[model samples]
Target: MTENEREIVRRITDVLEKMASGRKPSRIEYTETDAPDDSTLMELEAKVVELNNLYAESYRFILDLARGKLNGDPPPHNNFVTPFKQLQSELRHLTWQIEQIAAGDLDQMVYFSGDFSRAINQMIDDLREREELRQQLADSNHAKDKLFSIIAHDLRNPFNAIVGFSEMMVQMVNMASPADLKQFAEMIHTSAKQTYNLLLNLLEWSRVQTGRIDVKPMEGDLALLIRTNVNISSITAEPKQIQIYYDGGDSYPVTTDAAIFNTILRNLISNAIKYTPERGEIRISVDTNNRFYYISVHDTGMGMSEEDVQKLFRLDVIHTTNGTNQEKGTGLGLILCKEFVTMLGGDIYVESEKGKGSTFTFSIPK
Candidate 1:
């Protein structure tokens, strides 16, 4: 073969070798016309030999063509380069697949026939998991923002009343008569009680959110606890002529938190006293089954619709209703009652009609 023909064959064979090797061909250095320096040429030959080993397993025909071109050997009789050409096409396809995956296209599920494909697929799966976790965290933050927003807006009214009423009563005491002073004192006491109850509920609810209200089971008399709270709350009820009664004389005892038991009674009795008209009646009763110790407080007062009962215990919301004698309610007592009852392994439920009355029933394990 002539020198020009040999050079052409070498260039074509170089392209074929790169196609089989699954790598881009480096720029060819073809300036020397004479046989190259033995040492430098031998180094290049060693590299080609290393490639030849890979080509023997992957593309023997391409390696044979490259060697034949370098030696100025005759071309193949049939000129068939079909199999090597197909290998080059597959290499181009793999390069495009890598570029697509890098550009955020992970929909293609690469078959794990080789180590290279498996490594790339694993990387894609890791990226997808991180993206999903990021989205979930963003959603959680959004929900927290909404909760705090509701809490801030709803808490403002009760706080304003407590502060305003406290300051006003202090100023009025100096100029008032004994009778007027007594009324003012009562107003101040009621406002202070409301403020204190609000704070207590807020603290308890925070504890509940932090998983602190663990129910320590103990035995206690449910009826006696109810009667004691009713007696204590009677001072507030008497002035308005609200009569309180207990339907069950039986001293039923149950395993629960006694402190929370007192809190539930105080809140319910207070609510009954606040909402009932003068000369109205409130009733207390205890009933039990195999599974539960049920206590109920029923009042013939200004009752609520289904909607008001539904929102009764929500901490991030505020609701209020006026007493018959224009008594103010901060709405925190019912929320506190609900939380305390729940902590004692109990559930609270309410039943009411708009015009007739309201009943709050709670049950704890017997």
Candidate 2:
């Protein structure tokens, strides 16, 4: 064949090889090595340039996908390039799939049929779990903020009352009658008691929140525990002419933490006294079923609305009410009671209507 014909044959052979292998062909470096005419050489040069351009576009497309830049510009869209065109189409689909996942659509599944798909799905699951935990922590932090506010309010009121009453006494002790002195003293004593109870509940609740309160249950007499707390609580109740009764019979036995049980019972009885009218009656009773020991404190007091009952024992939504005689309440006692009761493997509830009365009930294992 002539030199010109040989050059044409060589270029044709190169094109066929590239098509067969489905690989991008590099630039054809045709120069004056044999000096074919300029026009024939230019034709071969254009084909080579086209092939190089196809590979360049394909390279840029893969690079963009790797860098996670899914916006702007696409790959070479020519159908003559088999694998490059196919890859560009698939990458567009992958981008849409990822966008769906980003927009809170976990149900948008990817079925790429390989380890790659499995890895992507696992990543989605991890992201979802992290979001859920983040939300829970936020809610917990919000509740803690409310708790601190209640503490500040409870502490400030009693201290101010004590200080004011003491100041009045210091100034008027010489001129005041015995009746005035005794009244001031009693006021001081009441403020001190409210402050002390708040501190106790605060300390115990802090320990429970930090997961440091350990429960050690033992075989014990429930009747004796109720009687002991009732005696101690009567100190507060006697002043209001309230009568406290406990008929928890001779030997009601249960397995429980004595200290926690005592605190729970004391808080309920104290609350009943606070809400009950003067000369009212509060009866403590104990009953049992096959699974648990049920204890209740029933009172004929000024009860509460259902809305107010729902607000009790929640740190985030606290609504503390004063006693019937305008007595102060710290709001921490019931929260501590709830936590302690839960720790003792029991549940506590109250049945009260606005005009009627209330009965606080709790149950623990036998």
Candidate 3:
């Protein structure tokens, strides 16, 4: 064409070639001249300059995105950079989701299509499962520590008492008075019984932890079971003059695992006798709702505070206290009662006030 058109064509070709080669193109400029094609050439040159500027902006924006500089200035609104802007928005959202996940929100999920989405969701699920297992392991370790503490402290005390008192009795058998001999014998007996109860509870608790205990339920006389436990517990209670009163008329029928029921009753009765003062009273009573039998062991004993009661069933806390007669406890009996009650498809609760009394009630399905 003419010189002006030829110059315009050359500039446009150079700009297009630079852009095609992924290089920033220089700004296009055209001077106004008194030629017939000047206006059209100038117009074309303006379009070329605009295209070069757009290409430079797009290239910078894409470079920032590639470098993970998500907080930089966003691309201008244009058809050419629309997909990049959308990608930036998605990436910002993903960053926020990742931050939330890092802050312990495992529920965050990525929904973008492709392997990234699947990988992120899978990571969240794995983190949640790992957290659950970590919590379980911590609880298991705490339980083990509590058991070891009881065995080391509580079990050792009773055995020491038994051994010390029996040895004293043997050494003084020929020289000691009848009253002293009887006293030593009684001490040994008390310590032996305590040791036996602790050992039995430890065994049963271990069975429970191992998932080896089975519930064997049968229909039987509930009152007889209560009376039996009360009778056995009375051997200890009579010394403190703590009277146990159970008047279930000898024929309270119920369905339960008889062995578990007996163990629960034995512990409750023993606890009551242990804590109740001389001349105090223990009342065993049963009430029935439409679906369950509620058995209560109410005792006029040195009761616990609200805080101590709250600590009673938690494995992470050991809440033992001396009985009214300075009787030592491992605080394991109530824990066992709770476990056995739960195994029998029941729940146990306690109501007590400091220095007033405590009532332990458990429900069994009728």
Candidate 4:
């Protein structure tokens, strides 16, 4: 029934009808037959069929791309190729750009000209800002965790000792000998003093954390600060027979916060006395250049290993160690000292040998 009407126009119309219904053409042997009278119509129909095949191939590549299959070389966009291959190339480039950003290269930018390029560039910028904020939050959380650990473990110990010793004196004073009474009282005094000092430093650290401490820098005498600390330290040093030495010229001034300078000196000297054996020595000295003042506290005491020195200033590490004569410390003093020194635009450092001694030094900008 179809042999009489198998003209080129009818054949192309049948092909379009099949494609329009989302169907494939049936396989059939086409025998040579009389061509259409309109030669130009047959040529146009042949080109249309070729274009249809071309578009189908591109659709396959595009379908894979839609599913995130960005690998492998694709056919080049040629004369027969429309915007599909161009899209494939763009997607492949976009895939690489995304990989670079995930690898921490936030500077990558897309240069394609369109809404997609602009959107991608904006997304990269947003990611960069968020990455910076994420880092700051991580640092703050780490500081908080370190402070909590010290409070929960180290601060509790000294307070417990003070309460226990004081309670013992109250309950046993009548039955205790005069010597036992004096020893128990001395123990209570030592524990209370240590606890009080730790509390003061902890309060100051809290102030720093809450952004309450405004740094007010002024010119002040570094020597006088050292002298004041030396006098205060001597009261505790004398009890252990530890000799304190001070070396600095009069009126050696620097631009700094007096309170912060005083805090650094007090903590350093206090640490020295805690670690020194009976009859050991501590020396405080000062040196300076045009732009900065350097203060040092050197001690003839039980020294530290390299690892211990490294851990001393880290809040995340287990840093607490018993001082000589079983003196208790919260490790907060050095942490506070470092924070204060840094606020005044200075850096504190420690030099020590395992069996020798430790010299804590700091340089403050003048």
Instruction: Return the top candidate by lDDT.
Output: 3
Model 2 over residues 1-366: C-alpha lDDT tens digits? Answer: 667757766766766576467564444444433555555655765566566556545655556656765453554465444554455567678778999999988776676757988998998888888888997788578558766776678788888989998999999999999899899888999899888987887788878878889999999998888988888989889989999999778888788999999989999999999999999989999988998888999999988898988988877776888899997785678888888888988898989988678999998888
TM-score, per-candidate, Cα-based: 0.55, 0.68, 0.80, 0.73
Greater lDDT among 2 and 3 belongs to 3
Q: Candidate 1 on 1-366: residue-level lDDT in tens? A: 556446545754674577577763343443443553344544554455444444434344456544542222222432344555554455556667778878878775665358877887888899888878987677456435534643565355556665676676678767767787676566656666665765676676567656787767678877888888878887778988888998876688677788778777888888988888888999998888998988899999999988888878764455777788876665667766877887777899999988788999988888
Instruction: Provide the clashing-pair count of each candidate structure.
Output: 0, 0, 0, 0
Every model: Cα RMSD to truth:
12.8, 8.4, 4.0, 6.0
By summed lDDT, the worst window of 10 consecutive residues in model 4 runs over 24-33
lDDT of 3 at 40: 76
For 1-366, candidate 4 gives per-residue lDDT tens digits of 234234766767866776678654333334334545565665666666765665555555656777877663454654444465677678778888889988989999888877978898899899999999998788678778877877787678877877888888899988999999899888878878877887899899899878898888887777887888899899989988999999778878677889888888899999999999999999988888888888999999988998899998766665777888888777888988998989989999999987677999998997
Answer with 1 or 2, whichever has the higher TM-score: 2
Q: Against the unseen true structure, what C-alpha lDDT does each candidate score?
A: 0.70, 0.80, 0.86, 0.80
Residue pairs with backbone overlap in model 4: none
Q: How accurate is candidate 1 locally (lDDT)?
A: 0.70
Cα error of candidate 3 at position 91, Å:
2.2
Clashes of 4: 0
Q: Residue 218 deviation, candidate 2, in Å?
A: 1.5
lDDT of 3 by residue, 1-366 (tens): 788688778877888888889665444454444464667777877787787776676777778898998876755665667788888889999999999999999989898878999999999999999999999899889889989999899999988998898889889999999999999988988889888988999999899888899998898988888888888888778989989999556577788899999888888999988889999999999888788888999999998899999998888898899999899998888988999999999999999988988999998886
Query: Model 4: what TM-score?
Result: 0.73
- Model 2 misplaced stretches (Cα beyond 4 Å): 1-136
